[model samples]
Target: MSKRVARIGIFIALAMIFSYIEVLIPFSFGIPGVKLGVANIVVVTGLYMLKPQEVFFISILRILLIGLLFGNVMTLSYSLAGGILSFVVMYIFKKLGSFSIIGVSAAGGVFHNLGQIIVAAFILKNEKILYYFPVLIIAGVVTGILIGFVSDKVIKTLKIQDFSENLK
Candidate 1:
């Protein structure tokens, strides 16, 4: 296999590991569907380091693999909804080229939660689930910022841009 393919495989593995780690951690904040978004560190890194399409590929692959490994049909559905929406939002922000990584990631995080909430509302058939929006927004911002900072550090320390060039 080519080095590029190998690198992508490595990234996917890292994302899956992160997802498993997040599951292992009991980080309930008294609100359902709130998470620290640890796997997003890989997603954000890919957004900056890989092609847009490649990033989407990695994100979707990770979500599906995680769902199969650790979740059921409902988990897969919710994850798919949140992951797709988050990826779109982040891609748009990245294309705009105005927002810093933190800003883009923050928006992505917020929208990710929003997407999941929307799915939950539809699944439950209750508008009351929307009440979680405000709290989720705050959680998203916090987790997004955290993920962004970590991604930034990883990008800089690893020289991801330079490495990406080598991969190509």
Candidate 2:
């Protein structure tokens, strides 16, 4: 149990590190609210390496930590929505067991954007934001594929499955 808790701590730290890196790099799509979501690589990896609930805990905790450190209340709202929605979609796809990690990541990315869009629409009280949905979807799929590929490699290279089995 201590080992698992320690590992979860590590995962949260890694996720925060990735988020910090994203802030430093600021790889934008030349559009507002479009980000590479590099932190999600850790989330994606956790989905495969840890239990769904553990992964969920890590993702949410990371978002809260990062938001508190670097973002405002609005950013937190958007992130919470995106993180929750993306986690749900990723979890469903992972449970389906037919989708590749890439596919699951892609779904997660797209849904993450969708969640943010929903929040934006609600907060802005304007439906015009929906017009940006298509672009976000594209960006999401592209980033998701890249993040997924990286996650897949990380999992295999680290033999995370083998390591996590011991946690069980």
The lDDT leader among the candidates is 2
Where model 1 places Cα greater than 4 Å from the true spot, the runs are 160-162
Q: Report lDDT per candidate.
A: 0.89, 0.93
Per-residue lDDT of model 2, residues 39-129, tens digit only: 9999999998888899999999999999999999999999999999999999999989999999999999999999999998999999999
After superposing candidate 2, which stretches have Cα over 4 Å from the reference? 160-162
- Each model's total of backbone clashes: 0, 0
93-156: candidate 1 lDDT, tens digit per residue: 9899999999889988998998888998999899998988899999989888988899889888
Backbone clash pairs for candidate 1 read none
